[model samples]
Target chain A: MAEYKGVMTYCEIAEGSLPSISREVAGFGRKLADDLGEELCAVLVGSDVGNLAQDAIGLGADTVYVVDDPLLKEYQTDAYLSVMEKVVRKMMPRILILGQTSVGRDLAPMLAFRLDTTATLDCVGLAIDPGTKLLLQTKPVFGGNAQATFTSDFCPQIVTVRDKLMPPPEPDASKQGEVITLDAGLDPAAIRASLLKRVTENEGGVRLEDASIIVSGGRGIGSAEGFDQLQELAALLKGAVGASRPACDNRWLAPNRQVGITGKIVNPDLYIAIALSGSIQHLSGCAQSKSIIAINKDPEAPIFNYADFGVVGDWKKVLPAFRDKLKELLPG
Target chain B: MRIIVCIKQVPDPQASSSGTKVDPEAMRVIVPQGTPPVMSPYDENALEAAIRIKDAHGARVTVISAGRNLAKPVLRKSLASGADELVLLEDAAFEKLDSYATAHLLVAAIREIGEYDLILCGRQAADTDAGQVGSGIAEILKIPCITAASKVELSDGKVLVERVVSDGFEVIEAPMPALVTASSEIGDLRYPKLKDLQAAQKMPITVRGAQALGIDAAGLKRVNLVRLAEPPRRKTECRIIGGETPEEAGANLALKVKEAKLL
Candidate 1:
């Protein structure tokens, strides 16, 4: 029997340096490695991503494995999965951590299937059981209406975590680790799907993920035109404009601005929810906001339960007055 | 072209925040009786995407659902929405299946169907939200799978899929006999006409079990669901800013927000 040992995090990179998700998962993996009293290993894959090995060490990885190859440049299902399989097979880490982003979501499960182990997706909470040393994976289910904890008696327990749930570890340049470069023996014939073109919808404004404050509207905002008012309010506060799923589905806002379980998870300092009844799925996205303010006519709207301050009224009458009051309160 | 769309019947995901209850003892959600189950939202998009392809290229779209006891009224909607056939893979073991097991069953069923050009599934079920089965099936069958597809077109012996990514979308092309997972952005399931609705209800549904599908239910490893519970509630003492009129209330709310110094 191959005795799986230590924690391994699959590091993701965009442009050149590691993305925040890579750091976040590394931080999370660091905690697990500590609990298990084992080495934390990070795998850096992609074209010329070897420079990030020390960075991963600073994020708490004791050993960083670099598989820098041109064939592994962009995330193709087969290329990345094949790379991950070789890494997992070679190292045989007891635990594997991945971000619930585009690449991880696609790769983790397939890798799990190939390895004959189970992979838990979108896990918001994870812990190592002190008694038997099993990974307890906690994740939301039933449209975020409820959460479930799961465990499997399998080696290399795999998990993909939702974003923004954990902060990245503080970087310490003093930290050092061993970097092992592996040959990515990938075959071009193994690449099944090909990326033709990429289209980026650049909504020129503060990205919801990086925003300190978010002014979000919902179905009650009515139409596409109503978002302009939300945008104005967001601009006044130097924040970003976000929307509930309904608003996005109605084409009133782009899907990227959606804050919910299936959408982007945000942790803005202040979340202003307008004309939106808070659903569990939506709250799963923005509940980490430092403070929430809700405005809706229905006093019983669930948003109030999570709001620090709330106003009961029609947004049509209130928004204009809000603009006026804020305009008077602050300077451009 | 033959298309297979996988759908799951779940407790209404569109239900209000308070519509669900978790039975921790059973580690399952207790769906209230009399509240009919609806097709998971993304599966509807998957069906709609298939129908769009069917309308354009004249392909046969078959809807396959694997569950314990599915609602026919709900399953019929796929047909009413334009699926040409309905196949249900049902067994007691079908309930609360882990992604791997579900994928195992689906791959078996798809094999039984024999020939297929494309396999379409919802990005993830509105229930588990695991989003793994599609990728698993593709892997087990060794086929290319594109997930979170917003737009799919069959063009010149290839499947062109506009997949939803974090920053934007990516146009991916794969050869025939591929799989694609539809995201909600593809568009909601279309409402069927009265004639189509009637025809769908009368449509014959093929039902099979684990034994029939050649799946040894007792042999698979099931991920133990330890417990089900409500997320820890954030108890916020809400201060309702009030005034005589809506405008006055808005002004008061603005002042209160500043006082809070949230940003």
Candidate 2:
């Protein structure tokens, strides 16, 4: 444990740039390393990703390790895991942080297992205990009805944090750091999984994370066509459309459009829930919205408890009038 | 093809919050009286994935579940849905085993069950929601693992999986004998026919304990659960818009939105 003396953030690159989650974990990793009076580092693994070392330094990592390889162009489990295992074995950081995305969720647990350690995934909060120097991982459980904190008694404590949960990294452009390049040691035979292709099928619209207002529906939306109605309203307001887990499970909405404990978290200026009963699972994602409005026939729906405004009616009847009024009131 | 689907029985997530309550002091949920446990929803999706593969190709589907006290009737749904065999890994010490221990036990059971080509599991449990065991089991078995798969297609002794990413889905390919964690995107489990359900109830189940698997479950926990508590409450009094009709309510709701300067 004494040999593992620093914090390491596993940074991810998307479309030739550092994603928001990479910056966030790096920022939070700095605080953890500082608290332990240890160094902070970042591991950048991807093709042509070494150029971001300065950005990593600016983001608070004292040292940046670059593993540049063409084979690492896109994420493949076998290749990424081998690279991560090599880096961790070399750096031996006391704490490892990763973003809770498709990659991290797949990699962290396997990496931890390979190293004979444990990892806490999808953490909403992380803190270093002052007295015992333990990294406490706080996460939601039981469909977000309950919360639990966990601590690992192992080296290189790994945790995958839910994206956007932490404040963004404030880069100091003037900051400088050490950069080291490592070779993954070519062995194509070692990689088992191959990426066939990545398909992007998201409907053209304002991304929910970037939208200021979101029009969301639920089981009551009925069909894909019903979601189209919500999408029209979302377009009218220059917002995005989302749905509860039921709608996503029913395939009425793309799985990515699902907002709940198992889906993406969004915090917009306003969230309009149409015929969706706000279960704790669903609220876990959008409860942080500035204002929530619920339109449901069930006056006793749990959504009303957390909503700022309620309209007890069928959305088919209520939505048109509301959309029509908004069309008349607002200038595009 | 030999596909093994891992499932777990949990307090029905569809049940209202009133059906279950968290016991902060004891660090567990108090199951409501008379509410029968259901297969974790994602696990049902996993079983559905297995059945679909079996439907498209000639394969045998075996369902394996590990827990302290698993309900036979709830697990029988897997058989009714199309599983040919049911294997239950049960023991007193299996109740609170960590993800690694759970995976280790499953791996042992997989080993004992002999030949297998592909393994499937839910993305995460509805109760604990850790989502680690499937990946851990894959790691221990040294096989490629694809997590959060929406569609899995088999061809030429390999599997092409469409997995959900942040913005969309990506296609990944791995050799057979790999593991996949299915998500809701795979779609809901099929409702078994009444005749099938009746036949499943009469099927024999193979039950194994920790001693049979040669694992000391009590010694496998590596992480400490510090405490459990209700998540911070988010509350506000909802102001209901009044109107003579539903259409009027909609018009009035829009006015409120405008008043709030939200649009």
Candidate 3:
């Protein structure tokens, strides 16, 4: 057996705090580390994010590694990679976990490549094989038609977990842990990419992952007006409005709100899929939701196969009436 | 300037595999008949990005791929779509490569190209959906990598790109001789004209095997597929609402959903 040591998680800082996905990953990684009887460590990299290091500890990291530097204020691959590679080489943890965000999706593979290993991306389920003591990474394969479990032969196994699948850890303010700040030796001349500016969409402060209820539309919604109705319903319920890949591909919605295999994986308490034919890829992402209600005109749509309640009707006529009924029923 | 685009051939993603079965003995997914394989959609975006760069600046667009039993029509379609040259790396031993091994082969082929100002690839492959190869190649080649690039433009000896993020998009500028993975926002792939399609048929394709590249044919296996099985199906006795009109059905559904307290 390989003598791997600890469980390390990469905690990303966005808007001066850890994103919801990082909190979920840390929660899951903490349990896995405890099961293996190993130390739980968190890696945080940014300009002035030492405070987030303490937040990671409160969320259950035993040791928090901090790499604070001005060059790392914005995430450039080389600068962050330089710090992470050194940390991994020095610590040599058994398992490396990361949130499957755009940054993680890009950095994990490069780190695994440098370490001569492979990674499992967008994994939905994870468990340890009791006999072999290996991480069993389960992910959707073949465009989400089937599921595949993969294990790496390398010592430090790398895994990128999907967002909204795992629950976020409860923070304990009184928890104490060790924090170590390392010298980030980055040479500005060696970095090739520079951040010019970041442009963000005004999404009204609602993120898809944190919402408990989601009302999603698909291409069958007919036009942008359909999404407007869906948004009205979502607003009434105080939930987020999501869309399928086709809707995003058609520019009916922003790509950020897409929920499917290629987009965000959501685990809301209730998922209302409207005018969407449930493709395997789309189902795989939302499969873990507690309850699902599907609405489509076609009775034979695959969505009904997995939906708890199915309504067959044209969205144009149905959505407006549904909204009116809901408003009437739950008048504040 | 020379631009290299790496494309992959995958089964059509939109094809429903309700009747498809897994060949556990061979470790392959058997697609339903009549669903011809096409270039992965994001890779099509990558090719389009390269061609657009070539159109803006005079550059040669060379497209490359690594797979077994390379399809002629698929590879020719890329050339017809505007790639100046095509290179296919095929071998029996290359069948079960993980991202690491695939990146090794691509980096070798790219090194052979000798002179390239930029390399482009899809954000992720449609089949495995593992988006590791592009970053792997960039890391091995010691070049900068910009991933999930929705828009790419060539400037004076540098490239400016808009990358998709969780919140929105970030504009990044990188020096020449870098790699970028294209997202669907790059734009729709252009259709080849009749003359371009005719010229693509006459264009020569460079094919290489493991032996041709001085690699051991039998020793290239790195990652192993442990098992493949159907995911546990969600069994639900769906209670479908039936009404004379869409409005009636919608009103009933709202009442039912409200009764269930799902909202």
Candidate 4:
């Protein structure tokens, strides 16, 4: 067995900028590295994301490895995997961490299989076992009904942490780190997959991760028209409009707007859930929010158990008046 | 064309949490009361994807599952749902195989089946939600793997897939013998007619074991669940608004939200 060394985090870039998950994972990786008495590193793989190394150092990484190549501009599975495999083999990190995004979900498994290692994805909690020095990865299973902790007796324990579970550490601008640029050594011919084009869909006004306030609707929303009301309220508050799985499955809202275990996990300042019964799956996603408000017609809805404020009534009648009251209270 | 679709049966996810319990001693979940084991919802989507492909290209669809004491009714339901054949990879030792071992076992079964053009699986099993086996199978087979595919088609001898991305969807082209993990967006599974259900009940299903597939099940586990417990419960006491009508509750809730500074 190869002797394990340090903790490394794979940084993700979106829309030509580093997503908050990169920093969040860095903070998380920093803690794990400190506990293990090893170095913390970050791998930035993109065409021109080299400048991201400084920010990564500020966030937590002591060493930033860059794999800059034009062929790596857009995320293609084979291309990214090739670079990651090379990096992991060279660094021999004891632990590897990634964001539980679409790309990470696809990449982590393939890499783990290739490395002859094991990975736990969409993990909510991570800890170190002082006894054996293994990563204790906790994630919701059976749709958040129960939690299971897994440990891998292998080098490079790979884990993909759910977004927003931990806040990124404060960055000191004066902090310095070593930024090393390495050749991706990627040959386009060796890659079996190629990106023909990229498409960007127009999501609702605010991105789920960046929203401070969110208004979410569920099965009780009735139809696409019902979501329109929720959208109006969200727009007024300058927040995002999210939905439970049923809302998206019914095609009343876009799949990306769904907020739950199967959807985007959010931790906003305040989450206003309307007409949602608060299934364990949906609650698991937003459980980290600072405060939650539930509005449903059923007085016995499960959402009430986790909500700070509850209202029992028809959303159709309640939403309009609530929107109007909000318009009155915060006149812009 | 020959297509293989893998499916797993799990407890219905929609079952109320009140009946769900965790057995820390066994480090496993006791299925919620009154919830029968059913085909995983996402696997239904995968089966639907296979049926659609078969319908389009005049192909044969074979559904395979690796588990312990595989239920007959559940596998029969899949057959009624348009699968041309059913194969059960079972063993008492196979009961607790992780995703890695599961993929290896499935790969061996596929190899024994001899010929296949495409393989499909659910994006993730609802039980573990590891979402790794599909890609793992693809890696061992040295085939291109696409995940979260909402749409898949056999186009000019290549697999054309529309996979979901964070922002939107992307269409990818891969050669034959590729693997795809179907997502819920693939559309609803087709309901089998009464006649088909009756016929499926009489059809012979093939059963195989780890010895038959030449895999040592005990040696393949790369990860294991160390402990299991119910997630910590939220400790918020919901303050229900007192109101005579929906309008009254709405107004008072707005005031309360304002007081909470959550508006």
Q: lDDT of each prediction vs. the true structure?
A: 0.88, 0.90, 0.85, 0.87
> Could you give candidate 2's per-residue lDDT for residues B1-263 as a string of tens digits?
89999998888877735446779888886767776689998889989989998999978999999998899999998999999999999999889878888899898999998889999999899888999999998999988899999998898899889999878888888987999999988988999999999999999999999998899877888989988877887778899997999999999999998998876
Instruction: Give every candidate's TM-score on chain A.
Output: 0.96, 0.98, 0.93, 0.96
Residues A45-136, model 3: lDDT tens digits: 99999989889999999999999998899887777777888888888998999989878887898888887777888887777778777888
lDDT of 2 by residue, A15-66 (tens): 8888888998887899899988999999999899999999999999999999
Greater lDDT among 1 and 2 belongs to: 2
Clashes of 2: 0
> In candidate 3 chain A, where is summed lDDT lowest over 10 consecutive residues?
A198-207
Off by over 4 Å in 1: none
Q: Tell me the number of clashing residue pairs for each predicted model.
A: 0, 0, 0, 0
Per-residue lDDT of candidate 3, residues B187-260 (tens digit): 77899998988889889999989878776634544556777877678888889976789998888888988898
DockQ of 3: 0.70
Q: Sort by TM-score, best first.
A: 2, 1, 4, 3
Q: Give the TM-score of candidate 2.
A: 0.98
Report the lDDT tens digits of candidate 1 across residue range B1-263: 89999998887776534767888887778655555689988999999999999999899999999889888888998888899999999898787788888888888999999999999999898888889889888988889989889899988999999988777789999997999999888998889999999989999989999889889644674588887997777789899999999999999888877677664
TM-score, chain B, predicted structure 3: 0.93
lDDT of 1 by residue, A71-143 (tens): 8778888888888999999999999999998888888988998898989999989999999798999999887
Candidate 4: interface RMSD equals 1.5
User: What does each candidate score in C-alpha RMSD?
Assistant: 1.4, 1.3, 2.0, 1.5
lDDT of 4 by residue, B160-179 (tens): 88887767778887887889
Looking at model 1, residue A6 earns an lDDT score of: 92
Ranking of predictions according to lDDT: 2, 1, 4, 3
Task: Supply candidate 2's per-residue lDDT for B222.
Answer: 90
